[model samples]
Target: MSMERIATALDRVSAALRRKPQAGIHDDAAATARWDGGLRTRVLHDAGHELLTDMPAEIGGEDGAPTPGWFMRAGLASCAVTRIAMAAAAEGIRLETLEARASSRSDTRGMLLIPEADGSAVPAQPLEIALHVRIGAPGVPAERLRTLVEWTARCSPVGCTVEQPMPLALHVDVAS
Candidate 1:
């Protein structure tokens, strides 16, 4: 059996006064290559379980985990930070720091790890992610950072996740 996902992001958004930005999105995933020369150690992904605990303690975290979700943990943070950096660079604003953290919960009454519909064992959906980003843009006004947030909200992967509903698309591209 095979699973297929379809995704389409608007290249242009509507604007009241001027034309909106030109941007697009594709699909991606978190995994390592199947082959390596000598080192072949497997790594666990933080996905939903360990996403919250994989951060520094000074920045709102306890920092306890067995190397969880190293791949997905920074998915949103990196993307969002990159966008902010780009915006700041474009405006000649210097940045000092950037960070992202995430937490999540499901409507399972705090019982099941993943809520199931129709008593099916399979996971019905991904839980909600409470994501936050802290960016230190020196010499940049707060209003400009707000604009950067707006732009990232429309462009970054994590930003898109926060904007609309849950995940509705998945794609695995590979050829050999």
Candidate 2:
């Protein structure tokens, strides 16, 4: 879709949300992941969408699909792109090129629950995450693009989620 159309749609949504603040609250459907085999899982989402995750052969997996961490990185990249596009459209900036690249470093010992040399606990999360965004537009200042990218980082859903961890509630049920 054209940026003008996107801007129009966004304006409509923004007006609606302003009129009814509660309209901005979104409750997403639950996504369930079932283990397909060793170190492999199949996730089911809305509209019959399915995603698969598997570790490398060295990790006792078939290496058939991307790992969960890869998916998280992909999500962050895609979400940043989406937010950037939206912001540019709203601001009437016609982008010639836009890209977001996300990368992270993970410690295997942390993931495997291996204790440190001092018998301390290691975090099971990525040690560092980085996102590099490239954006270009004709007749637009580079500083403006930088500001837009910074704004996108603050507003992107996945970016925000990764930056600020949320509380998770886990429930387990024993099957007969």
**lDDT on C-alpha atoms for all candidate structures:** 0.51, 0.94
lDDT agreement of model 2 with the native: 0.94
Q: RMSD of each candidate?
A: 12.5, 0.9
Candidate 1's TM-score reads 0.47
Which segments of model 2 are wrong by more than 4 Å?
none
Question: What is candidate 2's CA lDDT for residue 148?
Answer: 92
Q: 1-176 in candidate 1: lDDT tens per residue? A: 11111111111222321352333243344544332222222443446321222333543334553223344446666777766665565555666776777555434323344435555564323356656767777677878777776777687765576556585577788898
